[model samples]
Target: MLLALDLLGIFVFAISGGLVAVRNQLDIVGVVVLAMATGLGGGVIRDVLIGAVPPPALDDWRYLAVPAGAGLVTFLWHPAVERLERVMNVFDAAGLGMFCVAGALKAHDYGLGPAPAAALGMLTGIGGGVIRDLLAGRVPVVLRSGELYAIPALAGAAVAATGVELGVRPAVVVVPGAVLASGWRLLAFRKGWTAPAPRVSPPR
Candidate 1:
Protein backbone atom coordinates (compact mmCIF):
# COMPACT_ATOMS: atom_id res chain seq x y z
CA MET A 1 0.00 0.00 0.00
CA LEU A 2 2.79 2.40 0.89
CA LEU A 3 4.63 1.44 -2.27
CA ALA A 4 1.52 2.11 -4.32
CA LEU A 5 1.08 5.55 -2.77
CA ASP A 6 4.72 6.28 -3.43
CA LEU A 7 4.25 5.40 -7.09
CA LEU A 8 1.04 7.41 -7.37
CA GLY A 9 2.71 10.39 -5.79
CA ILE A 10 5.56 10.14 -8.27
CA PHE A 11 3.13 10.04 -11.17
CA VAL A 12 1.24 13.08 -9.94
CA PHE A 13 4.38 15.11 -9.37
CA ALA A 14 5.58 14.20 -12.85
CA ILE A 15 2.31 15.36 -14.36
CA SER A 16 2.61 18.62 -12.48
CA GLY A 17 6.13 19.17 -13.75
CA GLY A 18 5.02 18.41 -17.26
CA LEU A 19 2.17 20.86 -16.87
CA VAL A 20 4.62 23.46 -15.66
CA ALA A 21 6.71 22.88 -18.76
CA VAL A 22 3.64 23.42 -20.86
CA ARG A 23 2.98 26.62 -18.99
CA ASN A 24 6.58 27.67 -19.52
CA GLN A 25 6.41 27.18 -23.28
CA LEU A 26 9.16 24.60 -23.10
CA ASP A 27 9.91 22.23 -25.92
CA ILE A 28 9.14 18.53 -25.93
CA VAL A 29 12.58 17.67 -24.58
CA GLY A 30 12.25 20.25 -21.87
CA VAL A 31 8.89 18.86 -20.86
CA VAL A 32 10.29 15.36 -20.53
CA VAL A 33 13.32 16.52 -18.57
CA LEU A 34 11.19 18.59 -16.26
CA ALA A 35 8.78 15.73 -15.70
CA MET A 36 11.51 13.31 -14.68
CA ALA A 37 13.28 15.87 -12.55
CA THR A 38 10.20 16.85 -10.59
CA GLY A 39 9.02 13.29 -10.17
CA LEU A 40 12.25 11.60 -9.10
CA GLY A 41 14.28 14.46 -7.73
CA GLY A 42 13.17 14.11 -4.13
CA GLY A 43 12.97 10.32 -3.99
CA VAL A 44 16.36 9.88 -5.54
CA ILE A 45 17.90 12.26 -3.07
CA ARG A 46 16.27 10.51 -0.15
CA ASP A 47 17.40 7.08 -1.27
CA VAL A 48 20.96 8.17 -1.84
CA LEU A 49 21.11 9.84 1.51
CA ILE A 50 19.84 6.66 3.12
CA GLY A 51 22.43 4.65 1.19
CA ALA A 52 19.99 2.78 -1.01
CA VAL A 53 22.76 2.11 -3.48
CA PRO A 54 21.77 2.57 -7.13
CA PRO A 55 18.45 4.08 -5.99
CA PRO A 56 15.13 2.39 -6.68
CA ALA A 57 14.19 4.82 -9.42
CA LEU A 58 17.43 4.08 -11.23
CA ASP A 59 17.35 0.37 -10.53
CA ASP A 60 13.73 -0.04 -11.59
CA TRP A 61 13.04 1.19 -15.09
CA ARG A 62 9.31 1.56 -14.39
CA TYR A 63 10.17 4.56 -12.30
CA LEU A 64 11.50 6.13 -15.45
CA ALA A 65 8.37 5.15 -17.38
CA VAL A 66 6.04 6.74 -14.85
CA PRO A 67 7.34 10.26 -15.22
CA ALA A 68 7.96 10.03 -18.95
CA GLY A 69 4.44 8.73 -19.46
CA ALA A 70 3.12 11.61 -17.41
CA GLY A 71 4.96 14.10 -19.58
CA LEU A 72 3.54 12.54 -22.72
CA VAL A 73 0.03 12.72 -21.36
CA THR A 74 0.54 16.37 -20.58
CA PHE A 75 1.77 17.00 -24.10
CA LEU A 76 -1.17 15.21 -25.65
CA TRP A 77 -3.92 16.76 -23.51
CA HIS A 78 -2.61 20.19 -22.69
CA PRO A 79 -5.91 22.04 -22.72
CA ALA A 80 -7.53 19.54 -20.37
CA VAL A 81 -4.42 19.55 -18.24
CA GLU A 82 -4.45 23.31 -18.00
CA ARG A 83 -7.98 23.19 -16.68
CA LEU A 84 -6.90 20.97 -13.82
CA GLU A 85 -4.55 23.42 -12.11
CA ARG A 86 -6.99 23.97 -9.23
CA VAL A 87 -6.96 20.24 -8.54
CA MET A 88 -3.19 20.18 -8.85
CA ASN A 89 -2.69 21.43 -5.32
CA VAL A 90 -4.62 18.50 -3.93
CA PHE A 91 -2.42 16.01 -5.76
CA ASP A 92 0.66 17.97 -4.88
CA ALA A 93 -0.36 17.87 -1.25
CA ALA A 94 -0.89 14.13 -1.46
CA GLY A 95 2.51 13.76 -3.09
CA LEU A 96 4.05 15.69 -0.24
CA GLY A 97 2.33 13.52 2.33
CA MET A 98 3.29 10.24 0.73
CA PHE A 99 6.88 11.24 0.09
CA CYS A 100 7.28 12.32 3.67
CA VAL A 101 6.17 8.90 4.88
CA ALA A 102 8.26 7.08 2.32
CA GLY A 103 11.37 9.09 3.03
CA ALA A 104 11.12 8.78 6.78
CA LEU A 105 10.40 5.09 6.56
CA LYS A 106 13.34 4.49 4.27
CA ALA A 107 15.58 6.41 6.63
CA HIS A 108 14.43 4.35 9.59
CA ASP A 109 14.86 1.15 7.62
CA TYR A 110 18.45 2.16 6.96
CA GLY A 111 18.95 2.60 10.70
CA LEU A 112 18.85 6.33 10.84
CA GLY A 113 17.41 7.89 14.00
CA PRO A 114 14.21 9.90 14.32
CA ALA A 115 15.78 13.30 13.83
CA PRO A 116 17.50 12.49 10.54
CA ALA A 117 14.52 10.51 9.34
CA ALA A 118 12.22 13.46 9.88
CA ALA A 119 14.64 15.78 8.13
CA LEU A 120 15.00 13.42 5.18
CA GLY A 121 11.24 13.10 5.06
CA MET A 122 10.97 16.83 4.76
CA LEU A 123 13.54 16.82 1.93
CA THR A 124 11.82 13.96 0.13
CA GLY A 125 8.60 15.96 0.24
CA ILE A 126 9.84 19.18 -1.36
CA GLY A 127 13.11 18.48 -3.12
CA GLY A 128 11.42 17.75 -6.42
CA GLY A 129 9.53 21.03 -6.57
CA VAL A 130 12.73 22.83 -5.74
CA ILE A 131 14.50 21.17 -8.66
CA ARG A 132 11.64 21.83 -11.03
CA ASP A 133 11.46 25.49 -10.14
CA LEU A 134 15.22 25.92 -10.41
CA LEU A 135 15.25 24.32 -13.85
CA ALA A 136 12.46 26.65 -14.89
CA GLY A 137 14.46 29.70 -13.83
CA ARG A 138 12.30 30.58 -10.85
CA VAL A 139 12.79 30.40 -7.12
CA PRO A 140 11.14 27.42 -5.49
CA VAL A 141 7.75 28.05 -3.88
CA VAL A 142 8.82 26.57 -0.55
CA LEU A 143 11.56 29.15 -0.37
CA ARG A 144 9.17 31.92 -1.24
CA SER A 145 6.47 33.48 0.88
CA GLY A 146 3.71 30.90 0.82
CA GLU A 147 1.44 28.95 3.06
CA LEU A 148 2.83 26.27 5.35
CA TYR A 149 4.51 24.08 2.75
CA ALA A 150 7.28 22.05 4.38
CA ILE A 151 5.64 22.17 7.79
CA PRO A 152 2.85 19.75 6.89
CA ALA A 153 5.30 17.29 5.38
CA LEU A 154 7.49 17.64 8.42
CA ALA A 155 4.52 17.00 10.69
CA GLY A 156 3.41 13.98 8.67
CA ALA A 157 6.88 12.46 8.55
CA ALA A 158 7.34 12.89 12.25
CA VAL A 159 3.96 11.30 12.90
CA ALA A 160 4.61 8.38 10.59
CA ALA A 161 8.12 7.76 11.90
CA THR A 162 6.98 7.90 15.51
CA GLY A 163 4.27 5.43 14.66
CA VAL A 164 6.81 3.11 13.07
CA GLU A 165 8.99 3.24 16.16
CA LEU A 166 5.93 2.42 18.28
CA GLY A 167 5.15 -0.66 16.15
CA VAL A 168 1.92 0.80 14.90
CA ARG A 169 0.35 -0.55 11.72
CA PRO A 170 2.70 1.43 9.52
CA ALA A 171 0.43 1.21 6.52
CA VAL A 172 -2.60 2.40 8.44
CA VAL A 173 -0.72 5.04 10.37
CA VAL A 174 0.99 6.45 7.31
CA VAL A 175 -2.13 6.78 5.20
CA PRO A 176 -3.89 8.98 7.70
CA GLY A 177 -0.71 10.81 8.48
CA ALA A 178 -0.32 11.61 4.80
CA VAL A 179 -3.93 12.70 4.67
CA LEU A 180 -3.37 14.92 7.65
CA ALA A 181 -0.48 16.61 5.93
CA SER A 182 -2.48 17.01 2.76
CA GLY A 183 -5.34 18.51 4.70
CA TRP A 184 -3.02 20.95 6.34
CA ARG A 185 -1.61 22.01 2.98
CA LEU A 186 -5.02 22.56 1.41
CA LEU A 187 -6.32 24.34 4.47
CA ALA A 188 -3.29 26.56 4.49
CA PHE A 189 -3.92 27.39 0.88
CA ARG A 190 -7.59 28.09 1.51
CA LYS A 191 -6.91 30.22 4.52
CA GLY A 192 -4.07 32.09 2.84
CA TRP A 193 -1.99 31.12 5.82
CA THR A 194 1.64 32.19 5.79
CA ALA A 195 4.51 32.81 8.12
CA PRO A 196 5.13 36.40 9.03
CA ALA A 197 7.94 38.21 7.28
CA PRO A 198 10.03 40.77 9.05
CA ARG A 199 8.87 44.37 8.82
CA VAL A 200 10.62 46.46 6.22
CA SER A 201 10.53 50.19 5.56
CA PRO A 202 11.10 52.16 2.41
CA PRO A 203 14.68 53.07 1.72
CA ARG A 204 15.49 56.66 2.48
Candidate 2:
Protein backbone atom coordinates (compact mmCIF):
# COMPACT_ATOMS: atom_id res chain seq x y z
CA MET A 1 0.00 0.00 0.00
CA LEU A 2 2.76 2.42 0.92
CA LEU A 3 4.56 1.69 -2.32
CA ALA A 4 1.36 2.24 -4.24
CA LEU A 5 0.78 5.48 -2.43
CA ASP A 6 4.29 6.60 -3.32
CA LEU A 7 3.70 5.91 -6.99
CA LEU A 8 0.33 7.62 -6.98
CA GLY A 9 1.79 10.63 -5.25
CA ILE A 10 4.55 10.68 -7.83
CA PHE A 11 1.99 10.64 -10.60
CA VAL A 12 0.09 13.51 -9.03
CA PHE A 13 3.17 15.61 -8.55
CA ALA A 14 4.36 14.75 -12.03
CA ILE A 15 1.12 16.03 -13.51
CA SER A 16 1.49 19.26 -11.63
CA GLY A 17 5.03 19.59 -12.89
CA GLY A 18 3.91 19.04 -16.45
CA LEU A 19 1.22 21.65 -16.01
CA VAL A 20 3.85 24.10 -14.91
CA ALA A 21 5.89 23.26 -17.95
CA VAL A 22 2.90 23.85 -20.17
CA ARG A 23 2.34 27.20 -18.55
CA ASN A 24 5.98 28.02 -19.24
CA GLN A 25 5.83 26.95 -22.87
CA LEU A 26 8.55 24.42 -22.32
CA ASP A 27 9.42 21.77 -24.87
CA ILE A 28 8.72 18.07 -24.41
CA VAL A 29 12.19 17.38 -23.05
CA GLY A 30 11.93 20.22 -20.56
CA VAL A 31 8.53 19.05 -19.46
CA VAL A 32 9.78 15.55 -18.84
CA VAL A 33 12.81 16.75 -16.93
CA LEU A 34 10.82 19.02 -14.69
CA ALA A 35 8.12 16.46 -14.06
CA MET A 36 10.60 13.79 -13.10
CA ALA A 37 12.52 16.18 -10.91
CA THR A 38 9.45 17.45 -9.14
CA GLY A 39 8.13 13.97 -8.58
CA LEU A 40 11.29 12.34 -7.29
CA GLY A 41 13.42 15.14 -5.89
CA GLY A 42 11.80 15.20 -2.48
CA GLY A 43 11.76 11.46 -2.10
CA VAL A 44 15.39 11.33 -3.06
CA ILE A 45 16.21 13.95 -0.49
CA ARG A 46 14.20 12.18 2.17
CA ASP A 47 15.95 8.91 1.50
CA VAL A 48 19.34 10.55 1.59
CA LEU A 49 18.56 12.22 4.90
CA ILE A 50 17.45 8.94 6.41
CA GLY A 51 20.32 7.05 4.81
CA ALA A 52 18.16 4.93 2.55
CA VAL A 53 21.25 4.09 0.50
CA PRO A 54 20.78 4.65 -3.22
CA PRO A 55 17.26 6.12 -2.78
CA PRO A 56 14.10 4.58 -4.16
CA ALA A 57 14.02 6.70 -7.27
CA LEU A 58 17.40 5.36 -8.27
CA ASP A 59 16.84 1.79 -7.15
CA ASP A 60 13.44 1.44 -8.78
CA TRP A 61 13.38 2.63 -12.35
CA ARG A 62 9.59 2.87 -12.21
CA TYR A 63 10.02 5.91 -10.04
CA LEU A 64 11.69 7.49 -13.06
CA ALA A 65 9.23 6.03 -15.53
CA VAL A 66 6.12 7.31 -13.80
CA PRO A 67 6.94 11.01 -14.10
CA ALA A 68 8.27 10.62 -17.59
CA GLY A 69 5.02 8.91 -18.51
CA ALA A 70 3.01 11.68 -16.91
CA GLY A 71 4.87 14.28 -18.92
CA LEU A 72 4.25 12.33 -22.07
CA VAL A 73 0.58 12.05 -21.26
CA THR A 74 0.34 15.77 -20.63
CA PHE A 75 2.15 16.57 -23.85
CA LEU A 76 -0.01 14.31 -25.95
CA TRP A 77 -3.26 15.68 -24.56
CA HIS A 78 -3.22 19.43 -24.72
CA PRO A 79 -6.96 19.65 -24.27
CA ALA A 80 -6.78 17.49 -21.21
CA VAL A 81 -3.91 19.59 -19.97
CA GLU A 82 -6.05 22.67 -20.48
CA ARG A 83 -8.75 21.05 -18.43
CA LEU A 84 -6.43 20.41 -15.51
CA GLU A 85 -6.84 23.72 -13.73
CA ARG A 86 -10.17 22.54 -12.41
CA VAL A 87 -8.60 19.53 -10.73
CA MET A 88 -4.99 20.60 -10.23
CA ASN A 89 -5.49 21.70 -6.67
CA VAL A 90 -6.85 18.31 -5.74
CA PHE A 91 -3.78 16.57 -7.08
CA ASP A 92 -1.41 19.02 -5.42
CA ALA A 93 -3.13 18.58 -2.09
CA ALA A 94 -2.95 14.83 -2.27
CA GLY A 95 0.76 14.89 -3.08
CA LEU A 96 1.48 17.26 -0.25
CA GLY A 97 -0.41 15.23 2.33
CA MET A 98 1.05 11.90 1.34
CA PHE A 99 4.64 13.09 1.12
CA CYS A 100 4.53 14.98 4.41
CA VAL A 101 3.14 12.13 6.45
CA ALA A 102 5.44 9.62 4.85
CA GLY A 103 8.48 11.78 5.39
CA ALA A 104 7.71 12.35 9.07
CA LEU A 105 7.06 8.70 9.77
CA LYS A 106 10.16 7.62 7.92
CA ALA A 107 12.21 10.03 9.92
CA HIS A 108 10.78 8.83 13.23
CA ASP A 109 11.33 5.26 12.25
CA TYR A 110 14.94 6.12 11.53
CA GLY A 111 15.40 7.22 15.15
CA LEU A 112 14.97 10.92 14.71
CA GLY A 113 13.22 12.99 17.36
CA PRO A 114 9.88 14.70 16.87
CA ALA A 115 11.23 18.11 15.86
CA PRO A 116 13.57 16.81 13.20
CA ALA A 117 11.01 14.33 12.01
CA ALA A 118 8.42 17.06 11.70
CA ALA A 119 10.85 19.23 9.83
CA LEU A 120 11.61 16.35 7.50
CA GLY A 121 7.90 15.99 6.90
CA MET A 122 7.64 19.59 5.86
CA LEU A 123 10.64 19.18 3.61
CA THR A 124 9.18 16.09 2.03
CA GLY A 125 5.94 17.90 1.31
CA ILE A 126 7.38 21.14 -0.03
CA GLY A 127 10.87 20.24 -1.17
CA GLY A 128 9.80 19.26 -4.63
CA GLY A 129 7.76 22.43 -4.99
CA VAL A 130 10.75 24.46 -3.96
CA ILE A 131 12.93 22.78 -6.57
CA ARG A 132 10.26 23.20 -9.21
CA ASP A 133 9.85 26.89 -8.49
CA LEU A 134 13.55 27.43 -8.48
CA LEU A 135 14.14 25.59 -11.71
CA ALA A 136 11.19 27.42 -13.26
CA GLY A 137 12.48 30.73 -11.93
CA ARG A 138 9.26 31.43 -10.07
CA VAL A 139 9.01 32.37 -6.43
CA PRO A 140 8.28 29.30 -4.37
CA VAL A 141 4.72 29.10 -3.09
CA VAL A 142 5.81 28.15 0.43
CA LEU A 143 8.53 30.77 0.60
CA ARG A 144 7.15 33.85 -1.08
CA SER A 145 3.53 33.99 0.06
CA GLY A 146 0.69 31.63 0.77
CA GLU A 147 -1.94 30.91 3.35
CA LEU A 148 -0.85 27.87 5.36
CA TYR A 149 0.98 25.70 2.90
CA ALA A 150 3.76 24.54 5.19
CA ILE A 151 1.57 24.83 8.23
CA PRO A 152 -0.70 22.01 7.15
CA ALA A 153 2.30 19.80 6.50
CA LEU A 154 3.54 20.55 9.97
CA ALA A 155 0.15 19.75 11.41
CA GLY A 156 0.06 16.48 9.55
CA ALA A 157 3.44 15.58 11.00
CA ALA A 158 2.28 16.32 14.50
CA VAL A 159 -0.80 14.23 14.00
CA ALA A 160 1.39 11.36 12.84
CA ALA A 161 3.50 11.69 15.94
CA THR A 162 0.46 11.72 18.14
CA GLY A 163 -0.81 8.62 16.45
CA VAL A 164 2.49 6.90 17.07
CA GLU A 165 2.31 7.86 20.73
CA LEU A 166 -1.22 6.52 20.94
CA GLY A 167 -0.20 3.22 19.33
CA VAL A 168 -2.48 3.63 16.35
CA ARG A 169 -1.30 1.88 13.25
CA PRO A 170 0.09 4.16 10.55
CA ALA A 171 -2.57 3.06 8.12
CA VAL A 172 -5.25 4.04 10.58
CA VAL A 173 -3.86 7.36 11.80
CA VAL A 174 -1.24 8.88 9.53
CA VAL A 175 -3.11 8.17 6.34
CA PRO A 176 -6.33 9.78 7.53
CA GLY A 177 -4.50 12.74 8.96
CA ALA A 178 -2.77 13.28 5.64
CA VAL A 179 -6.03 13.04 3.75
CA LEU A 180 -7.61 15.50 6.15
CA ALA A 181 -4.78 17.96 5.67
CA SER A 182 -5.04 17.64 1.92
CA GLY A 183 -8.80 18.19 1.99
CA TRP A 184 -8.48 21.16 4.28
CA ARG A 185 -5.77 22.63 2.08
CA LEU A 186 -7.92 22.27 -0.99
CA LEU A 187 -10.87 23.93 0.73
CA ALA A 188 -8.63 26.69 1.98
CA PHE A 189 -7.29 27.30 -1.49
CA ARG A 190 -10.70 27.39 -3.11
CA LYS A 191 -12.06 29.67 -0.37
CA GLY A 192 -8.96 31.85 -0.09
CA TRP A 193 -8.74 31.05 3.59
CA THR A 194 -5.27 31.38 5.11
CA ALA A 195 -3.35 32.05 8.23
CA PRO A 196 -3.04 35.77 8.97
CA ALA A 197 -0.18 37.36 7.09
CA PRO A 198 2.42 38.87 9.26
CA ARG A 199 1.36 42.31 10.40
CA VAL A 200 3.60 45.12 9.33
CA SER A 201 2.81 48.36 11.09
CA PRO A 202 2.81 51.51 9.05
CA PRO A 203 6.29 52.87 8.77
CA ARG A 204 6.94 55.65 11.25
Candidate 3:
Protein backbone atom coordinates (compact mmCIF):
# COMPACT_ATOMS: atom_id res chain seq x y z
CA MET A 1 0.00 0.00 0.00
CA LEU A 2 2.71 2.43 0.96
CA LEU A 3 4.78 1.58 -2.08
CA ALA A 4 1.82 2.07 -4.38
CA LEU A 5 0.94 5.40 -2.82
CA ASP A 6 4.56 6.50 -3.13
CA LEU A 7 4.66 5.67 -6.81
CA LEU A 8 1.36 7.35 -7.51
CA GLY A 9 2.61 10.47 -5.77
CA ILE A 10 5.82 10.31 -7.81
CA PHE A 11 3.91 10.01 -11.07
CA VAL A 12 1.76 13.05 -10.32
CA PHE A 13 4.70 15.18 -9.28
CA ALA A 14 6.67 14.12 -12.32
CA ILE A 15 3.85 15.16 -14.60
CA SER A 16 3.75 18.56 -12.96
CA GLY A 17 7.48 18.89 -13.43
CA GLY A 18 7.20 17.87 -17.04
CA LEU A 19 4.51 20.43 -17.67
CA VAL A 20 6.64 23.11 -16.12
CA ALA A 21 9.57 22.12 -18.31
CA VAL A 22 7.40 22.26 -21.40
CA ARG A 23 6.05 25.65 -20.39
CA ASN A 24 9.61 26.89 -20.03
CA GLN A 25 10.49 25.59 -23.48
CA LEU A 26 13.12 23.23 -22.11
CA ASP A 27 14.35 20.34 -24.26
CA ILE A 28 13.68 16.65 -23.66
CA VAL A 29 16.67 16.31 -21.34
CA GLY A 30 15.39 19.14 -19.15
CA VAL A 31 11.94 17.63 -19.06
CA VAL A 32 13.25 14.27 -17.90
CA VAL A 33 15.67 15.76 -15.39
CA LEU A 34 13.03 17.98 -13.83
CA ALA A 35 10.54 15.16 -13.68
CA MET A 36 12.99 12.83 -11.98
CA ALA A 37 14.07 15.49 -9.55
CA THR A 38 10.51 16.46 -8.67
CA GLY A 39 9.46 12.86 -8.20
CA LEU A 40 12.42 11.62 -6.12
CA GLY A 41 13.91 14.68 -4.50
CA GLY A 42 11.54 14.83 -1.56
CA GLY A 43 11.81 11.20 -0.56
CA VAL A 44 15.56 11.37 -0.91
CA ILE A 45 15.68 14.40 1.38
CA ARG A 46 13.45 12.75 3.96
CA ASP A 47 15.44 9.52 3.90
CA VAL A 48 18.76 11.28 4.30
CA LEU A 49 17.50 13.36 7.21
CA ILE A 50 16.13 10.26 8.94
CA GLY A 51 19.32 8.31 8.24
CA ALA A 52 17.68 5.99 5.75
CA VAL A 53 20.68 5.83 3.48
CA PRO A 54 20.42 4.78 -0.12
CA PRO A 55 16.85 5.95 -0.12
CA PRO A 56 14.21 3.69 -1.59
CA ALA A 57 13.92 6.07 -4.54
CA LEU A 58 17.59 5.53 -5.30
CA ASP A 59 17.51 1.74 -4.91
CA ASP A 60 14.20 1.02 -6.58
CA TRP A 61 14.28 0.82 -10.36
CA ARG A 62 10.50 1.11 -10.51
CA TYR A 63 10.70 4.51 -8.89
CA LEU A 64 13.05 5.70 -11.59
CA ALA A 65 10.90 4.22 -14.34
CA VAL A 66 7.66 5.75 -13.16
CA PRO A 67 8.84 9.37 -13.32
CA ALA A 68 10.66 8.77 -16.58
CA GLY A 69 7.47 7.43 -18.05
CA ALA A 70 5.50 10.42 -16.81
CA GLY A 71 8.01 12.82 -18.32
CA LEU A 72 8.05 11.05 -21.65
CA VAL A 73 4.29 11.07 -21.89
CA THR A 74 4.11 14.75 -21.00
CA PHE A 75 6.87 15.58 -23.45
CA LEU A 76 5.22 13.80 -26.33
CA TRP A 77 1.70 14.99 -25.64
CA HIS A 78 2.36 18.33 -24.03
CA PRO A 79 -0.43 20.27 -25.69
CA ALA A 80 -3.09 17.80 -24.66
CA VAL A 81 -1.62 17.54 -21.18
CA GLU A 82 -1.41 21.29 -20.94
CA ARG A 83 -5.10 21.57 -21.66
CA LEU A 84 -5.72 19.58 -18.48
CA GLU A 85 -3.82 21.97 -16.26
CA ARG A 86 -6.74 22.48 -13.91
CA VAL A 87 -7.29 18.78 -13.52
CA MET A 88 -3.58 18.31 -12.98
CA ASN A 89 -3.64 20.79 -10.13
CA VAL A 90 -6.31 18.76 -8.43
CA PHE A 91 -4.18 15.64 -8.81
CA ASP A 92 -1.25 17.58 -7.46
CA ALA A 93 -3.23 18.26 -4.32
CA ALA A 94 -3.95 14.57 -3.96
CA GLY A 95 -0.29 13.83 -4.50
CA LEU A 96 0.63 16.31 -1.77
CA GLY A 97 -1.65 14.56 0.67
CA MET A 98 -0.24 11.17 -0.17
CA PHE A 99 3.34 12.32 0.21
CA CYS A 100 2.76 14.09 3.51
CA VAL A 101 1.05 11.09 5.04
CA ALA A 102 3.56 8.68 3.63
CA GLY A 103 6.43 10.80 4.81
CA ALA A 104 5.06 11.05 8.33
CA LEU A 105 4.42 7.34 8.52
CA LYS A 106 7.86 6.51 7.23
CA ALA A 107 9.47 8.85 9.73
CA HIS A 108 7.47 7.32 12.53
CA ASP A 109 8.47 3.84 11.42
CA TYR A 110 12.04 5.00 11.52
CA GLY A 111 11.70 6.05 15.17
CA LEU A 112 11.13 9.78 14.84
CA GLY A 113 8.87 11.32 17.44
CA PRO A 114 5.60 12.94 16.48
CA ALA A 115 6.87 16.51 16.10
CA PRO A 116 9.85 15.73 13.92
CA ALA A 117 7.90 13.20 11.95
CA ALA A 118 5.28 15.80 11.14
CA ALA A 119 7.95 18.27 10.12
CA LEU A 120 9.53 15.72 7.85
CA GLY A 121 6.16 14.94 6.41
CA MET A 122 5.52 18.57 5.52
CA LEU A 123 8.96 18.75 3.98
CA THR A 124 8.23 15.70 1.91
CA GLY A 125 5.08 17.31 0.63
CA ILE A 126 6.80 20.52 -0.44
CA GLY A 127 10.32 19.45 -1.30
CA GLY A 128 9.71 18.24 -4.82
CA GLY A 129 7.95 21.43 -5.88
CA VAL A 130 10.72 23.48 -4.39
CA ILE A 131 13.36 21.62 -6.35
CA ARG A 132 11.34 21.89 -9.53
CA ASP A 133 10.90 25.63 -9.12
CA LEU A 134 14.59 26.20 -8.42
CA LEU A 135 15.64 24.23 -11.43
CA ALA A 136 13.20 26.20 -13.54
CA GLY A 137 14.56 29.47 -12.12
CA ARG A 138 11.35 30.56 -10.50
CA VAL A 139 10.21 31.31 -6.97
CA PRO A 140 8.67 28.34 -5.24
CA VAL A 141 4.89 28.47 -5.09
CA VAL A 142 4.86 27.40 -1.47
CA LEU A 143 7.07 30.33 -0.55
CA ARG A 144 5.56 33.07 -2.65
CA SER A 145 2.28 32.08 -4.31
CA GLY A 146 0.24 33.09 -1.26
CA GLU A 147 -1.74 29.92 -1.75
CA LEU A 148 -2.76 27.80 1.20
CA TYR A 149 -0.44 24.96 0.25
CA ALA A 150 1.97 24.26 3.08
CA ILE A 151 -0.47 24.76 5.91
CA PRO A 152 -2.76 21.96 4.79
CA ALA A 153 0.21 19.70 4.23
CA LEU A 154 1.50 20.39 7.72
CA ALA A 155 -1.95 19.85 9.17
CA GLY A 156 -2.20 16.47 7.53
CA ALA A 157 1.27 15.44 8.61
CA ALA A 158 0.57 16.53 12.18
CA VAL A 159 -2.61 14.51 12.25
CA ALA A 160 -0.91 11.38 10.98
CA ALA A 161 2.07 11.68 13.25
CA THR A 162 -0.03 12.44 16.28
CA GLY A 163 -2.53 9.72 15.55
CA VAL A 164 0.21 7.14 15.25
CA GLU A 165 1.85 8.40 18.41
CA LEU A 166 -1.48 7.89 20.12
CA GLY A 167 -1.39 4.23 19.07
CA VAL A 168 -3.79 4.30 16.14
CA ARG A 169 -3.18 1.77 13.39
CA PRO A 170 -1.40 3.39 10.46
CA ALA A 171 -3.69 1.81 7.92
CA VAL A 172 -6.68 3.35 9.62
CA VAL A 173 -5.14 6.78 9.71
CA VAL A 174 -3.79 7.08 6.19
CA VAL A 175 -6.95 7.75 4.21
CA PRO A 176 -8.44 10.38 6.46
CA GLY A 177 -5.07 12.04 6.77
CA ALA A 178 -4.67 12.20 3.02
CA VAL A 179 -8.21 13.44 2.58
CA LEU A 180 -7.66 16.20 5.06
CA ALA A 181 -4.65 17.54 3.22
CA SER A 182 -5.91 17.11 -0.30
CA GLY A 183 -9.41 18.28 0.40
CA TRP A 184 -8.14 21.43 2.01
CA ARG A 185 -5.79 22.11 -0.88
CA LEU A 186 -8.48 21.56 -3.48
CA LEU A 187 -10.85 23.80 -1.59
CA ALA A 188 -8.27 26.52 -1.37
CA PHE A 189 -7.63 26.27 -5.06
CA ARG A 190 -11.28 26.36 -5.91
CA LYS A 191 -12.07 29.22 -3.57
CA GLY A 192 -9.05 31.30 -4.40
CA TRP A 193 -7.94 31.29 -0.82
CA THR A 194 -4.55 32.65 0.03
CA ALA A 195 -2.40 32.59 3.12
CA PRO A 196 -2.06 35.88 4.94
CA ALA A 197 1.14 37.76 4.47
CA PRO A 198 2.80 40.38 6.60
CA ARG A 199 1.37 43.82 6.03
CA VAL A 200 3.87 46.38 4.90
CA SER A 201 3.81 50.10 5.43
CA PRO A 202 4.65 52.35 2.55
CA PRO A 203 8.39 52.85 2.26
CA ARG A 204 9.60 56.01 3.88
* Top candidate by lDDT: 3
Candidate 1 yields a Cα-based lDDT of 0.86
Those runs of model 3 whose alpha carbons end farther than 4 Å from true positions after fitting are none
In order, the Cα lDDT scores of the candidates are 0.86, 0.81, 0.92
Q: Report the C-alpha lDDT of model 2 over 1-204, residue by residue, as the tens digit.
A: 778878988988887777788788899997888888889878778889899879868888889899899889887885677687677778778878988898888887888877888888888888887787778879986885767788888788778866765677777767776976787788788898878777899999
TM per prediction: 0.91, 0.89, 0.96
lDDT of 1 by residue, 4-106 (tens): 7677889899988898888899999989889999999998889888779789898878889999998899988989987887888788888888888888888
lDDT of 3 by residue, 1-204 (tens): 767867888999999999989999899999999999899888889999999999988787999999999999999999998888888888889999999999999999999999999999999999998999999999997898899989999999999999999999998889888999999999999999999988999999
Off by over 4 Å in 1: 167-169, 201-204
- Which sequence of candidate numbers ranks them by lDDT, best first? 3, 1, 2
Sorting all predicted structures by TM-score, with the top scorer first, yields 3, 1, 2
Which pairs clash in the backbone of model 1?
Answer: none
Best candidate per TM-score, number?
3
Distance from true location, Cα of 52 in model 2, Å: 1.6
User: Clashing residue pairs, candidate 2?
Assistant: none
**RMSD in order of candidates:** 1.8, 2.0, 1.2
